[model samples]
Target: MAGTGPQVARSPLELLNNQAAAEPPLLVKHAGPVIFSVVGFIAAAGANWATRRPLLSGVHRYVLIVGGSMAAGIYVEKKRAEHLATRDAMFRHYIELHPEDFPPYERKQFKDLFQEWIPIR
Candidate 1:
């Protein structure tokens, strides 16, 4: 919504009240892990309070925040990678089985005008 179109940017009133596209910044694997870390932080805080281990004030808190964020992000990334690999393999198999259906791919006549037109630049 913030960076959608020029109309929003052009309006002085809307521009003044616009919020950033990304909240909490893009520090850890985009903004996804940040949300996961928040949930983990809450759970860890509750556990820490209940146990009363008598450790440093916030040492465990900070550690859990980072560790939880990484754990969630890595798990999700791994799952996505596996799904993509499976889908790619299926497509390759289909292409091999029906080569006649898919004709030879021809290169576009003018791939990009800038490369040929603007040789000096």
Candidate 2:
């Protein structure tokens, strides 16, 4: 039964725990937000300056930008994973309802076909 299903893709943690998969680097994973981050940097800098906040505007901008990027990246990845997991589960159900509908023609369980996959928006 080890290879009977679609491979669940091994992540570092998955590999360690023997479960599901790996993830892209934060920069790569959250690249989409780079623009937003730039905008936010501008905004944070503005706020810092307008309020004359104790923190330096430049430092504040970088901190907010970096922190926001990392947070957004992690959040996006988590949501993506959850979405993928849900889709996979649905696929699994479909496989159950009509196994013949999928390929490999001889796959037993529904987890196989998934050695790895690219996440999409």
Candidate 3:
């Protein structure tokens, strides 16, 4: 007797293509942090070399310090932005899936919590 089971007949070429698509590209998946790390290392080495020279006066040193601090602040702010965006996306998804959990009034309160200003007039 022949087997009478539902079969998914996929061509070999189709399966290979599917697998290739499933695996992320090497550079796209892994090169980001590596490239950033290399660039950061190079920048740090250059900064160290520049600061070691006596040609940099007090003002130059101070400016470099302040500039490096600001760059750190900017990087932190960018990470914060990315985090907030992800959080907001998750919150939105949750709200969409379980709308009963967040009523209009509660939604307004949540929005107010993140708002820059609350009008009190």
What are the TM-scores, per candidate, against the unseen true structure? 0.44, 0.42, 0.39
lDDT per model vs. reference? 0.62, 0.62, 0.55
Residue-by-residue lDDT tens digits, candidate 3, 55-77: 43455554555566556655765
Off by over 4 Å in 2: 1-57, 103-121
Candidate 1 Cα deviation (angstroms), residue 41: 6.7
The reply for model 3, stretches above 4 Å from the true place, is: 1-57, 106-121
- Total backbone clashes of model 3? 0
lDDT of 3 at 18: 32
**What TM value does model 1 have?**
0.44
25-110 in candidate 1: lDDT tens per residue? 45644545666667777666777677895434577675867687768976877787699778766776676677677665444556
Candidate with the larger lDDT of 1 and 2 = 2
Off by more than 4 A, model 1 = 1-57, 111-121
Ranking by TM-score: 1, 2, 3
Q: What is the C-alpha local distance difference test score of candidate 3? A: 0.55
- Give per-model CA RMSD: 17.3, 12.9, 18.5
Model 2, poorest ten-residue lDDT window?
9-18
